[model samples]
Target: MDIGVGFEITYAARRAQRLSNVVLAKARTHTAESIDCER
Candidate 1:
């Protein structure tokens, strides 16, 4: 039971990490575009 719980926690952490990375990438792209537009 403990091992199963550990696996679930790790899986959740991985999913959260992926989601944050995707959001970070999109934010960076948006910032770059806005900066280009300013020029």
Candidate 2:
């Protein structure tokens, strides 16, 4: 059970990282578009 808990935490952390990257990429993409429009 202890090993299982640790494995679950590790999996969750990886998932969170992937999600964070997606969100950050979206923000960067939108910012770039807005800048292009302004120019």
Candidate 3:
């Protein structure tokens, strides 16, 4: 039971990391576009 719980926690953490990475990438793209528009 303890091992199963540990696996679940790790899985959740990995998922959260991937989600944050995707969000960061999108934010970076948006910022670049905004800067270009301002110029």
Candidate 4:
């Protein structure tokens, strides 16, 4: 149980979570654009 290692792990996890959120938002935006085109 090292302090630096624990901090790195937490930071990496946070970065990954943020990236996933960005990707999901982009996908939803694309879907909305397609739906708008259809209408």
lDDT values, one for every candidate: 0.99, 0.99, 0.99, 1.00
Cα TM-score of candidate 2: 0.91
Q: Could you tell me the TM-score of candidate 1?
A: 0.92
TM-score of each: 0.92, 0.91, 0.91, 0.91
Residue 13 shift from truth in candidate 4, angstroms: 0.5
Which lDDT tens digits does candidate 1 get at residues 1-39? 599999999999999999999999999999999999999
**On residues 1-39, what C-alpha lDDT tens digit does candidate 3 reach at each position?**
599999999999999999999999999999999999999
Model 1's alpha-carbon lDDT is 0.99
Question: Whose lDDT is greatest here?
Answer: 4
lDDT of the structure predicted as candidate 4: 1.00
Q: Could you tell me the lDDT of residue 21 within candidate 3?
A: 100
Candidate 1 RMSD computed on C-alpha atoms after optimal superposition onto the true structure: 1.1
User: In candidate 2, which residue pairs clash?
Assistant: none
Q: Which segments of model 3 are wrong by more than 4 Å?
A: none
Over 1-39, each residue of candidate 2 has an lDDT whose tens digit, in order, gives 599999999999999999999999999999999999999
How many steric overlaps does candidate 1 have?
0
Q: Clashes in each model (backbone N, CA, C under 3 Å)?
A: 0, 0, 0, 0
